[model samples]
Target: MAEVFIGSEEVAAGRVTRHELRRWYAPVYRGVYARKDIELSLRDRAIAAWLASGRKGVVAGVAASGLHGAPWVDPDVPIELVGVRIRPQHGLVPRADRIASDEITRVGGLPVTSRVRTAFDMGRHLERTDALVRLDALMWNQKFNRADVRALGDRYPRAAGLRRLLELLPLVDGGADSPRESRIRLWLLDAGLPQPETQIPVLATSTRPVAWLDMGWRDYKVAVEYDGDHHRKDRKQYVKDIARLRMLEALGWIVIRVIAEDKPSDVIARVEEALIRRGCSVEVDDLHRFARTFAA
Candidate 1:
């Protein structure tokens, strides 16, 4: 039987030979050589290398997302790494910031760029959306609030996503169960639609004083919703969705439905049209790419 994890003995004894290693199927990271069933993209390789190198690194930026269980972040994504104090001889240092005694820690047994120390290490170094997504996911899913992210950022003012996160973090709601909510919110924002409070109380005289709607517009009595495929396939959910829509209508709320393809633009147009008919005369303009910087 063979062991899954490799150690220094294998490296020294030549037990890790090219001929023997090639027979295995998992994707191998070059140089530092970590393997898992999933393919390691460039960013993955870099961070993995840094991690395997004897407690010398902590992965940050979009690349650290895999550890946090974010859906999918590009593996080659360039982020920052900070390690134990050493000389310039260890060239794996990407964005090297020499840390004083107070700034760094070994979180969960791995040498990590401290949550506060990350800004000085990697915050200002990523793309706008990538940076924002990481911040949002960390706060919402990881349960960090803007203040925690900031106090950490305050220690390292030049971090990658700090200022942008401070501005946008208020918008990240931990309650969203899927990416659909994010896409819908972003589309509506771009279209100049009034920001609808999500999971809001839809109130009217009824058996129940108030009920939650996925997305709601107050003045216009209109609601926008995303029906994930599970709702269609699950018989109980299908029935419940129909009943909910009918209930909202009876309760004086108009519901507009949205799906995946409705993304990028059509979602914006449909929402705008529905809102216009509701008596808000906001101009409907074409949704065009501004700079086309990053892929959603």
Candidate 2:
């Protein structure tokens, strides 16, 4: 309930004092500040905590993921929030969403805007790749469900960035930590190919789960994995890689290994070739249209 001061004309009905402002509040960035904390919060966390300090912290990106009940951030990722000053030491990410704070309202009792608004905010601040990663991870890994995010579109009818993020959501591949996977996924989407599944679990009646795949079409028995060259240079790891590939091949699984140079076109062609080889007639045309016609 305590409030950190922004600025005011009267500390005591007279001229402002620089000494007093520094004494009363620790400055954070231009107009922001921590009430009395000595350390400076990161650009992002300071802004988030500042807003969350009763000013309505509009959660987006990883912060929104946490609020939605699934926090999908790298271990090293700081705890980014908007609004408020008080925070734990060394690992918080706060940033200012300097839009009209008045229009923002709490969603799901968390200080975030409605899902649509949150998504909109995310598109603005986060890089497109970062946005896609969180979107894919949240929808697939966290199972937060896209319907919840979509449902808010009506409420935030004019939300700024929703349209773009929605367009790119399906293009986001699951289980991607690196930028290469991100690029591959986007390329597939652009080529109008079915987005490949990320980290799909494979289980058989006769055995326990032997492997979880990076990208695959389980129904078609087609698996596509990006094999960056870094894994094989050492003789020790190279031998192990060959054994794994041979075992997977013996299991009637089609494995396509590829690398960075194939960017854009190769991923699309490879997935298409695999599906066709497996007797699945689905063209790249009908891939992402799965949810378009059906209304849930």
What residue runs in model 2 are displaced by over 4 Å at the alpha carbon?
1-28, 31-44, 47-59, 62-117, 123-130, 169-179, 203-205, 228-238, 282-296
- Candidate 2, backbone clash total: 18
Worst 10 residues of 1 by lDDT: 287-296
- Alpha carbon lDDT at 43, candidate 1: 48
Q: What is the lDDT of every predicted structure here?
A: 0.56, 0.56
lDDT string for model 2 (1-296, tens) is: 12333444334554446676768676443344455654432333434354434454455556655455434454334555555444434454555544346535554444554444445556545777677766665554444435555655445656656687666654654476455666566655555555677776666556677677777777777776676677656787778777777777777788777676664455566777788888877544454444223211
How much is 187 displaced in model 2, in angstroms?
2.2
Task: Give per-residue lDDT, candidate 1, residue 112.
Answer: 50
User: Best by TM-score, which number?
Assistant: 1
Pairs that clash in candidate 1: 43-75, 43-76, 119-159, 123-159, 123-160, 123-161, 124-159, 124-160
RMSD of 2: 8.5
TM-scores for every predicted model: 0.65, 0.60
